[model samples]
Target: MPICTATLALGSVSGSLLFSNTDIASSNLHSSSVSSLLSPVSNFSKHSQRYCCSSRRTPWVCSANKVTSNTEINGQTSPVLQDSSVPPTEAVRQARRSADWEAARSYRDSGFICEGRIEGFNGGGLLVRFHSLVGFLPFPQLSPSHFCKEPTKSLQEIAKGLTGSLISVKVIQAHEESRKLIFSEKEAEWSKFSGKIKVGDILEARVGSVEDYGAFVHLRFPDGLYHLTGLVHVSEVSWDLVQDVRDVLTEGDEVKVKIISIHREKSRITLSIRQLEEDPLLETLEKVIPQDGSVGSDSESISDASNIEPLPGLETILEELLQEDGIIDVRICRQGFEKRVVSQDLQLWLSNAPPINQNFTLLARAGRQVQEIQLTTSLDQEGIKKALQRVLERVP
Candidate 1:
């Protein structure tokens, strides 16, 4: 009897082949002909090499329909049989895990971007299942569009409407040992503008909110329509002292700021309101304070002002200068334990006022000089009286 050779395409395994007919020549089945039978398994593994399938010991049965051609597997020609009852082998499961882990790493390093459907909320963030893995997207890592501002609503309650929403995300952290995967929709969103923003760039911004430490500004760039949030630290708010951010800034206030720093790793943009304006104190000092070749030619006199005693009757000279001009320029000569000595056009104003730690310049007469001028409340009459009394007492 002339024998017929048949090939079976199994439901699960990729490379396994079942050949039954003994009389037919193997040469007759060309590898090209069996490509159709391998379609199911090839399609399953296109995303990642990791795949799982049944590893049952039961023999796979071939139906009356037979595969007429040969198939390729791992560079060699091979083939499958359908086994309905078998489960995947332990070896297969491990291989699948290994492949999945490798895929996760690729996604992390290469920034494999993907979109996930929001399944639920974990009270602090959204839970999303993506690519056969479940990852947590923390609230802080969520895009501003999805963030809830309503204080009365719970995160889950506020996110209830987002249960079916699809969000674009990137895998940030992935660990197979702990089965932990972290995703950030915010990062994915910011990638669009990463190339556009740069340090020293000026942005027209609106105050988003004021915090104790700083204020967040919604930065507007001319090239992009999206608004990025940049932080303006309290110290960067203005040239003048700021006791409270709320005092200097309020929500929705439109202002211009300069980008001082960009932290790409953290996705943080640091802004400065002060940078947008020239520093008044420094600018004034540069203009009035004589440099090396100027009127104050003696560089040694400008040397460390620490050891130099207040010129004999220096306080008297300062009071005289203050009286003449109504306001004398005080150059910070040096600060000591309990006193600070300042110079006005080469003259000294040594006062027992508690030493001033900050670099400051003020236009003021003797009446405004205080022993310890409070930066925030320098206009206080009583504080100036105390300082003037101390200076006058030193003269006589």
Candidate 2:
């Protein structure tokens, strides 16, 4: 029997010793013989093999065992090394740490979600263990629920409460050489909810915050989880124009909203409160205006118009139209609004005064730029006059 030599090398990482065995077999060594003699490490492609280790309980057993032997020119047999009783040294541990960071980067760039156990806490965030590598999840990146609720509790106490919990996270930043591994639990939370959402889905939501342009709604799904968030533009608050979102929705207000758009990659959800409500103009047209093109007497129509509230800027524009053109014919058109037939000059004003669209716009009023005004109502001559007065009184 031809004998092969096996060499056991010892290395240290942070005072811990590791053993690696290199085995060189004879040129004619059988493949089965090698498998029977050496246990297999993790099977990774050449590039990945350095960073990923075997699933074995011991860390010392490595990919080196999988190396195939090369034949010598003189037909000399090489020694087969089976490492045994080697403890992981400081250097080996550092290398593993480097490997862990590399693994984190791979997961992040590939948009892979990882599940990890919360090990402990640091000043910046909680320490999360992804397999053998430990990653950092900053407190800000944590789910909103993780913040310390008790005023008396310190941040360390809050972190301690989360220790030992299993959490799902996405790699946000990963630097192997610099030993930086950052994860985001909040992103992971949204990712889990993203799959269940669709456009036109109605959901119960609470106003999280109100901005000038729109309001952020914390959506409650069918599962009763309030993890998803959506935005409701001011235009979507009501059928009538909205000058302030605060007037329509206060913080914590419960509202039914329809999902209008969804941008999953951007983690954005657009919602509409008006979609869940009947358009006031449509309602009035159905009840007040008969199918025979009759709206009762002119006085009755005036009374109906008086009951309807026009949008802020609409009254001013309509009052100007009414003053110039007497006895205006106000009729609801098929486009969900009454057609206003003003003089050609007034038509230019309608086109240039302000645009009525989904977004807000700044308008020059009294030689100063004023906040956006949305006109979203169908109204009679009387209603227009009243709304105009209100708009004029508020303008600077």
Candidate 3:
């Protein structure tokens, strides 16, 4: 059975009577239409909310699918066996709920975008007024199209202004049993803008929101409207290890990002911030060490180090490598050592090195700023020459 509520609350009708003369005369309810008094029902939620502020009417009749407390001057409000006035069986509830969800699912499966008003907001996200059932627009599901209106304003302020305004959204989820109906404005925008660009294309974007895993950036199309939002994973945020994304990205920061990947079906975009610059991990090592992992003869080999004077100790070798242009510090260490070298220089402590056949590390700054390069080998009484016999020969 369909869920319908058609109530006729007769203010002037006589008690225990369908219609009476004395009451109708005093309240002036005689002018009310009699035909609506028999009609079953129409819409429910939107009309049920209309509460009569003042008194004056022929008859309060709600001809909607649901019973409304307030109705216009039509005997339609009569308690004519409406759905709410009587308890419904499980089959009835399931039937109506299923009908509502079927319509919701149609919107989702068809990719039908529609205008919905923001009824209110809560901690989780915006509450959209969608007929009798309120659909939820989760904060994560909101797109740049929705937030770009006031890019710099706090979320609360923007939601306040959106309370009654309509926004274009599509149904992303509609599950009848769990009572979940979700909407996404972002997904709707993606269908419109995803075709305009492709992978490897560079675009200017604003950081809309930052989370522990990554930052969501709103891509600014050439037309100036933010049409799509993409994710910038924390690992792609920089060449340096990022412990916290907030340390580098904040909401509303303008940045240029490269599209590393795109998934059209999922409407996802992977972006990178570090790929814009050259990787300098090997800049400081190329001149000093055999890249092929071989010890070459003094002439055919380390040509860059041929002019170097033989060093007496590890500290001496440090002085020589530091002579390279823009080389700030040199460190040689075995792996699994202190990760920090840019902030503090412990190079002067090289005098504490143990002598002979011990696996040691030699670090050199070859114009790569303060980045550490690890070179592992044995060190003997002959000093650091044992570690760098290929690049710096023993002094006779």
- The order of the candidates by TM-score, greatest first, is 2, 3, 1
Error of 3 at 254 (Å): 1.5
Give the higher-TM-score candidate: 1 or 3.
3
Give the alpha carbon lDDT tens digit for every residue of 81-131 in model 1. Answer: 222222223223234345545566777788757676665564456666554
Structural RMSD, model 1: 17.2
Compute each candidate's TM-score over C-alphas. Answer: 0.49, 0.52, 0.51
Worst 10 residues of 1 by lDDT: 1-10
Predictions ranked by lDDT, top down? 3, 2, 1
Against the hidden true structure, what lDDT does model 2 obtain? 0.52
Candidate 2 regions exceeding 4 Å error are: 1-88, 120-125, 131-134, 144-160, 289-292, 296-299, 302-396
Candidate 2 accuracy as TM-score: 0.52
Error of 3 at 68 (Å): 23
Model-by-model lDDT, in order? 0.51, 0.52, 0.54
Name the candidate that leads on TM-score: 2
For TM-score, candidate 1 versus 2, the one ahead is 2
User: Where is model 1 more than 4 Å wrong at Cα?
Assistant: 1-99, 147-158, 206-212, 221-227, 250-254, 278-396
lDDT of 3 by residue, 1-396 (tens): 122221222232222122334333443322444432223211112221221111112234334566423222232322222343333322232333345466678787888776666766656667664443456776766777657767667777877778777777788877665556678888777776788889899998899779998998888889888888889998778755465899999888999999999999888899988777553333323332435544322112232332343222445655554554433445433212122333332221112234233433344332112212332233342344323332243321
